[model samples]
Target: MAILVTGGAGYIGSHIVRAFRLAGLDPVVVDDLSSGHREFVPDDVPLIELNIVRTKKLTEALRDHSIEAVVHLAGFKYAGVSVQRPLHTYQQNVQGTVSLLRAMAEHDIDKIVFSSSAAVYGTPDVDLVTERTATHPESPYGESKLVGEWVIAAQGRATGLRHTSLRYFNVVGSATDELYDSSPHNLFPLVIRALTEGHRPKIFGDDYPTPDGTCVRDYVHVADLADAHVVATQKLLAGQELEPVYNLGSGDGVSVRQIMTAVARATGIDFEPVVAPRRPGDPARIVASGQLAARDLSWTMRHTLDEMVESAWNARHQS
Candidate 1:
């Protein structure tokens, strides 16, 4: 009954892998050192250094290690990058997911905890969009993720493999340490990086309908987000009929301007951010209501915005 965590060496994947280990579960990891760190995974867990895109190698590793369930996280995720390289995004996210499913079905692994994204809901009309919201993804990255979900759903229906896709927005704060907090794409780290280098944090779209006229997003702490994954996976193991999709957010929407203010409050930095025009394909307000995860997974917010921001700042400085 070993859990096979794909991309376990990456930031969020490493946190989830560490969470599983901390909860008395030994997780086996399969990661190519593409965008992940080999040092992030604990020495105790078995590491099969192989690219999942290489189907034969991934299948060989799965059979060799007797992996029971998989937490699929290995994929390219930069939205702007995906825009430039749509084909690569499709191959990495969509094709990679199909390969994982084929290997799982072949090995008779019936359980999976998928890492879905909130990008599926691109520029929603409502303030707080729920899991039932219509998915009109505007970018190649979002399209790829939505397609990943489709692949899993289609496979799960044909085969009886149970799965739970947790759609997350923003994951901040420290899970293990500050060593893993230097991601270049996410907002929190982006701001911290700019401030650390004595550069102004750039804010896009400061004239929208919101109070600050900037895009808003939900920032869930990594630990609490990890906790949701644990609960979701446990439910699947218990023979529960997974909802197929659920939003894992705080239901509290924080604007970009508000995030800058929070950054200043959390880190005692007074550097102003440069107001830039709205980014291409940027969503104005993309906040998840997160009612389904709360009711079904029995999860709640364990950390505050201030706590999350401060922990992230502390992690940034400590590194």
Candidate 2:
């Protein structure tokens, strides 16, 4: 039986697929190729081109691949755009999660590592968020992820499904040049794209309550993030119990201005970023402790801020 990765052709998902392969585990991919690239998937790995919402096809693929566990990373991932397209967000994230759960139930594939987001906390009141932090999702994307977590938890309680949700903050950097982040909405890609195209990157809001005015977010390397998923999946499949949720964070906050400066330093391109009004549903700051993940999944910040910027810059150029 092989492990299944939903949305495995996407940037982060592809990295996780690489991690699993490095660990000597076989992984089958199921991606619709909507936002994901068909080439991102390794040639040796099986790629099932289907959306998770198509429960029947997904179930068939699960059965065909003899899938033992699922690392679910598929969903609508844009937090800013989710505000304008709440219905689409819910349909993709919430309904998609429900359909995946149903398919898993049919196949008795009880193990799952859900790809959650820090948006579940919305604009947190705490300086450092923990698993115990109350959820107050501001955008439909955030709301849908929180609801997905709820649904998964409910399924676990009802069916004894072994599961865990990883609430990650801003995911950046890359493990390989061939598998760079391709999301047009992500900050790293946006900045890299702007600079490459001879345009100054724009900061969404600079008047926030952050130290540098721009928003403060917890950034974690995508490679490190992917490793944690593999570890989580291994532990779950081994019949080890895990926390219902864990935050994969660095326990440090970096503002948007800091990121831009790092980008300039890494790329040797110095240009002032244009300051624009804050996007709706944006928070001034939100960082997490990652203490739980560190203890359980051996999660740690293996890459520095400059390293993150440099690696991302290198990968984008090589790709």
Candidate 3:
């Protein structure tokens, strides 16, 4: 039986596709190609070009592929843009999830690893966020992810579906030069774009309570995050019980200023970042503890900050 990967043509999704392949699993892709690149998916893999909300098409693809499990990553991913386009966000994230679940139920495809976001915690109150932390999402994107988890959990209870939701922190770096993040709203890509184009990278807020006067966040390498998904899917397929949720985090916080410094060192560029006013609802600091994932899924932060920046820089240039 093949594994289905939603949004397998996108940045993070593409990495998960590679990870699954490295583990000797067959993966089929379903993506709208709205924000994902067609070439990111390997030519050997079957690609069904369609949105997840197209229930009829998705159901047909599931049956045709003999899909036994799914790694769900397709959705509206821009948290900042989600605020301005709440309706569009819900249509893509919430409705899209509902449709995928419907298709899975029809085909008896019972295993799924949800690609969730730290946004669900919305500037969490604690220093180290855990699965028990209360959710208070501040953006439509975050709310949609949290809702997706709820829907998946409810389906699991009703249908005996084996599933787990992985709440990701800042996902950066690249596993290969062939695939790199192209999101205009993400930090790593934005900074890389600016430096390559001979522009100063901008730091939105520099007056936060962080030690360096910038927003502190938990950043994890994209490749590491993808490996966790593979492990989760394997356990679920093996009839092993897993937690309903896990935080794929670094357990340590890295300030934006430190990122800028790391970029300068990596790229051999020396320019002060342009500090702008803080965005509304911006949290001063939000890091997470990946202890649960580490214990269950072998989650680990295998890359240093410098390595993350350097790898991202090299991939952007080489691709």
Q: Which candidate is the best by TM-score?
A: 3
Q: Rank the candidates by TM-score, best first.
A: 3, 2, 1
What's the lDDT for all of these models?
0.84, 0.93, 0.94
Separately for all candidates shown, the number of backbone clashes (residues 3 or more apart, or on different chains) is: 0, 0, 0
* Candidate 3 per-residue C-alpha lDDT over 1-319 given as tens digits, one digit per residue, 9 for 90 to 100: 5899999999999999999999999999999999999999999999999999999988887777889899999999999899899999999999999999999999888999999999999877798999999999989999999999999999999999899999998999999999999999889999999988999999998888889899999999999999999999999999999999999988999999999999999999999999999988888998999999999999999999999999999999999
Assess candidate 2 and give its TM-score to the true structure.
0.97
- Candidates 1 and 2 compared: the better one by TM-score is 2
Model 1 lDDT per residue over 108-159, tens place: 8988988888888877888788888999887899898899899888888898
Per-model TM-score, in order, reads 0.96, 0.97, 0.98
Ranked candidates, highest lDDT first? 3, 2, 1
Weakest 10 consecutive residues of candidate 2 by summed lDDT: 277-286
Cα lDDT, model 1, residue 281: 71
lDDT of 2 by residue, 1-319 (tens): 5899998999999999999999999999999999999889999999999989999988887777788899999998998889899999999999999999999999888999999999899888899999999999988999999999999999989999999999989999988888888887889999999999999999998898878899999999999999999999999989998999999988889999999999999998989999988887677888999999999999999999999999999998998
Candidate number with the higher lDDT (2 or 3) = 3
